[model samples]
Target: MFAKLPFRTGTTSSAIWQGFAGSVMLLLGSLGVGWLASSSVLIRTPLFILARTTPAAVICATVLLCLGALLMFRAWLRLSQHLSGWNDDAGPVLRKALILWVAPMMLTLPLFSRDAYAYIGQGRLMQQDLDPYTNGISALNNYFLLGPDTLWTEAPTPYGPLWLWLEHLAVLIPANSPEIALIPFRLASLAGVVLLAIYVPKLAARHGFNPHRALWLAVLNPVTLMNFIASVHNDSLMMGLVVAGLYYASTKRAVVGILFVTASIAIKPITLIALPFVGLLWAGSRAGWVRKFALWAATLGISMAVMGAMGAVNGLGFGWLAALQTPGTIWHWYAPVGIGSVSLGSLVDWLGGDGTPIADGIQKVAQVISILIVMALAFVKIRLGPSGGLGADLPEPQRYSHAVMRRMAWAFTAVVLLAPMIQPWYVVWLLAFFATTGIKDGWPLRTVFYLSAFFILIALTDQLSVFPWISMEVVRSIAVVVAVMGLLYLTLWDKKTSELFKRNKPDQHAFAVKS
Candidate 1:
């Protein structure tokens, strides 16, 4: 029913009509709430000055969120169909239209993203020459930004170089209203989005893989577009660099690959540890080690110089270096720690000991465990023979050059699983890899379905944070269940798992036959 929707790109008029109609409904719903919320409160109040959030509006907004999700599901069904070669003719136009339709999402900051305010405050701190790591926004001491609502005013951004630079731009933009301040910041992410839309598919195609599938993962995935762009997170910029780096590796541009990967590292260093292993595999014994070494050093030197220039201009003066440490800090909704805390906290508190010890212990343990595991995986990936499987059969080079590609998939999967502070959009980086994995096999329908479903559920939790009226536990519990299932699948059901252990694995022939 969903797939047969009138939104198919071949039906050019209908697709545009559907997009316009849907976007209009969403905007009207948003405006209704805005009117009501703004009606009661001071227009300039920092904490959610919803001018029109009457009781009816709240119910209506929640319903709209759910409905918008359903619409997104319908869109995904069609996208998956095109990806599986069911309607191979639909790829180009569908991907192009998707890029256009979703562009506005990146332009606007949605309600759930009070996180953007915290980002602005942190950027203000950078501009004022304060360290965001320790002082948070409080150090800025700007009453208008600090606001009456305490939590958001002082909450620090636990983001990496990619995001801090983005936030720095937002603070620099001259604007009287906070909402106006968000516009330029939102525009900044568009470059990453455009690069992703262009490169991921082209690179996949170069390897004889289904560029369409990779395109969907990077471009059309809902959680990715919403959480990163609308929510204004900088993971897109970091991940875009990774994709560019991967594309370079696929094309055998090892030197360029290392440079792009280093820039990605400069954004979020933890995500790029796997890049060195990829370089090692590509450059084995006969390859030019000296040139590669020089390339890496040059890349790091260039990125650091750029960072230094930006920092100095913002009056940051290398202070952002210290801010990178906070990226390792765990958020309450993050994995491993949040997985145990959300799931076990209730049980522990019920058991009379209070869950403080378990919660505190997991936070400390997660950081150590995550880094250790990533290092171990990098070691295994580097020692591989030309075409030998590291843990799974790599894609045929002539068929698609998925050799290094496969290792990258496993590496990305590992980081997503182990990272102490993973938000839903984090999964977007891996989703692109997973899509290529599917194409390497055959028709990976089941794997595609599960991932799409998991994406919807995780996106729901992030969107759910907005409505203060909803029972927070209700949403958190849903997140716990969804995240746990995803974690279990990545760990236990990977290609490395034997048939017995992973009874419900995706199609075996999916990746088995390439061309």
Candidate 2:
């Protein structure tokens, strides 16, 4: 099946196959190094027990995982280089790659995150007729013994009703057993991946971008595979819906597009940022404030109706609105606001004052600032003279659609960067739109490529379950050394991949879409 897909002129069948092999390795290694919570049923399996009990097995598996991640990253870079322009075959090539890479991941225990387990626990809560918004997973018997993170024990679910309803159904299918429930959960996540594969190319082609490059950047990237496939995050489904919705809107089916975006919001409310852009898409390029305002009202009204209907099911209502505050509790250092909050709070503590309130205040202010920035980007038009910047050369008809997508991408980027916490996978929200709008070669393309590689490494090393007896520093050092070795080989030793680091004249028509 992999070989059947047409490859671009310069890309080799052998090179792409390396990524498929790497994914298989990743799955094998994950049996030892992946998240194996104490309550997980898999812990009783012989392979898992042997790997966890023996330090040597753990070390070997970690090395294997890191090596696999490096191989996949290198392959993706090589693939990116050959994507010079639009190829009708790009979609098939990327779709095949997606399947080959994602197949092995489906067999692994949840990698990089225990969120899938939390989904199962939340699903069980639904099975018991509990309102996940008001009650935490802790309401279940022996909830602490389950595989979900302790944070979810008391933290109400932040997911929307559609997601909760799906979770409820998933758990019920397995009689509330977390182990069996994971199968359905993963299958549900895979459905999202399928949506992405189908829509990303269509969206790219609709906007005159290279469908192949867009699909590669958004779908085949390692960060996307690990998060959406291995980690089983609901964000996958949310993003797929966003892309599908945007594609429909770009094609002039505004009402249908608005409905799709609303369904996306039902999966995760974060995509609510996209509603205004959908309104703009509906209002058309020459629409005045009155027309745009009316369309925006219509968009919101339709979205509210859809979301309200979903909320009404099983009496879930709109509690997810308030529960939206749940994820704000986490303050990852990667986020700008998170780091600023911590730095400012530390300074206050140095002066012998309570810094908790001050830190919280910073997050709130940053959140508000981010919202303002997104709104400004979405509404305020900046003139770039005759050549309208990124989408300036596009056909007049497509110019509006292109601009809206570009702004939507930036809007998602702002929200992720300025949010109280930024997860590695959150980047996918912006990536889908940016890829479709067109990422010009040179720094624009290189930046996205490098970031994808960096995130793959982060995902590889960040989530391993270290045993109590093992020195965490030692394990981290080993993983870093192995991963660095792999990087060295790709950047310095491999002929094809080495070209990525060399400075070259920028391609003037890199972003040009074939009409």
Candidate 3:
């Protein structure tokens, strides 16, 4: 257990015991999700000993969650008040372990327990040449014969072309048991992990942050591993592709970025948000108009072709053209934007979450707003290329320039915010891009990252039981939301961001530099 713990020092017995305790928590949090997924007496016995009712589960969840929140808050205050300094090395390390520790709590993802099975049942439909997008579980597969779980029997498929195609493909793996269904999907989620490992450090090193810190932040995020690996969400793969695209874009490989982001959009169209940043990169180039135009056009064309082929092969075709029609069909919190604005809009009626005339209208309005905002930023960047040569957020003195790396971080953030839904795994975008940013900017980046991870695990604690209460889930969700936002401010949005846009005018630069 201590082996996994990065910090520990003691003589003899105390050190040994502490190490053992740490190991146990880590293992239990990661693999112990079996409590909800499996009904084996072995798994249930201990939890039963701990507490049986929904209240007990809720209580346990509440206590740990609150404690975790306070711990994180303490860390934040320490950093913000200048009582302590993280430096480059220590800042990211603390964030890594905290984030990774959150993974096990996601075991509840399965134990909360409905979505994965619906994916199975839906995949079974695709096996029979049925369109899952338009159909429910009953269309291709019968419900009464399974383990009596609603996720398996009833939840509708809500994912898009790439996920549905993969879900359909996963069905062919020949499952002898329910766990086998989880096998391929879990393995598939590893694509994000691999990508994080391969690119985060490289991207970080390129941008002047410690590559090691960046690598740990992305590759080792618990929510990412838990949701994608244990929970089997596809966001990991989508995020991996998105970040890979960003990594390529940073290298001036706009074509590669386009192809990768296109592939991501096929998985989830929200990845398309990165296009503006990609466009920004194109505009940043010294290339002539024809060359820049050709690069942009070629990438867009190739991306569209890939999406079309993907849809065609999966029997989805251009059905996604109807995406605008089903505006409210997805969950709001499936992305960071959703989480950020959870309280801004009407409390979405879950049943009415399906697109209807009113919700559709509102969603369209919101979508348009997001577009206007993104497009406006990109448009401003175009002028920079033509007239200013370069904008700020450039490391030295720009008013607001993201550079290649900061651009990646901000681009990924926008991608998640504008996503159709917000899921826990969606944090991978943050995890991925955090690695690719410049120096820490005196923000407690690691501490915030750790805080977010703790709340995620606390949320998962409820999944340890059969009927985890909505009240507790709600409480946990709120705590997580607070933790996430607090962290966001500390880590990503702490400083004066306008500097990212352009260099201060010379007159102002003189004052600002000295100020």
Candidate number achieving the greatest lDDT relative to the actual structure: 2
Q: What does candidate 2's lDDT look like per residue over 1-515, in tens digits? A: 11122346556465578889888888888887777656766788797889876888888888888888888887788676665444565555666777888899898878888898788789879988898999998899987666788866799998988888888777677443465677877887798888888898777666666666777888888888888988888988888888889888888899889988988899889889999999888888878889988998999999998888888776888888998888889788767899899889999999999898999999998889889988998788633346646566666557778778888889888888888788888887778778888877777877876777667767876778777786667777888888877777776788888777666767743443433
Cα RMSD (angstroms) for every candidate in the order listed: 7.5, 3.1, 9.1
**What's the lDDT of the predicted structure labeled candidate 1?**
0.54
Candidate 3 residue 175 Cα shift, in angstroms, is: 2.9
Instruction: For each candidate, give its TM-score against the true structure.
Output: 0.73, 0.93, 0.64
Alpha-carbon lDDT of model 2: 0.80
Q: Give me the displacement of residue 214 in model 3, in angstroms.
A: 1.9
Backbone clash count for every predicted candidate, in the order shown: 19, 0, 25
Scored against the true structure, residue 77 in model 2 reaches a CA lDDT of 83
Local accuracy of candidate 1 as per-residue lDDT tens digits, 1-515: 01212234454444434443333434433432221111123344543335233445444554454445444544544444334442344466555656655655543335344555666676777677666655767666554442322454544444555567666787687766666656655665666677787777766555444565566655766666665665665566677777777677656676576667666665666555646554544454334657546544555565567556655665545554565555444454546656775457567888887776776676567657766665555444333355544224434443334544656677666656755566667677777665554443333444544565565556544544334565556545544564455445433553322121333534432222243
Worst 10 residues of 2 by lDDT: 1-10
Better of 1 and 3 by TM-score: 1
Is 1 or 3 the stronger prediction by lDDT? 1
Per-residue alpha-carbon lDDT of model 3 for 1-515, expressed as tens digits?
Answer: 00121222222223223223332343343232222334224334666435434454545444443343333333333322221222333334434443443334333324323456556666777888877666667764344332324433433454667777777777787655445565555655666666666676656555444554455445544454445554556677777787788667766687888877887787667676676566556445344666656666666777788888887777677666555333245545434444434433444554445334454455556567666765554443333333343233233312122354455455455544665564455566666666566434323453444544453544454343334433545545644665555445544554632122223322211011110
Whose TM-score is higher: candidate 1's or candidate 2's? 2
Cα miss at 190, model 3 (Å)?
Answer: 2.2
User: For candidate 1, what is the TM-score?
Assistant: 0.73
- Candidate 1 least-lDDT 10 residues: 32-41
Model 3 CA lDDT for position 98: 35
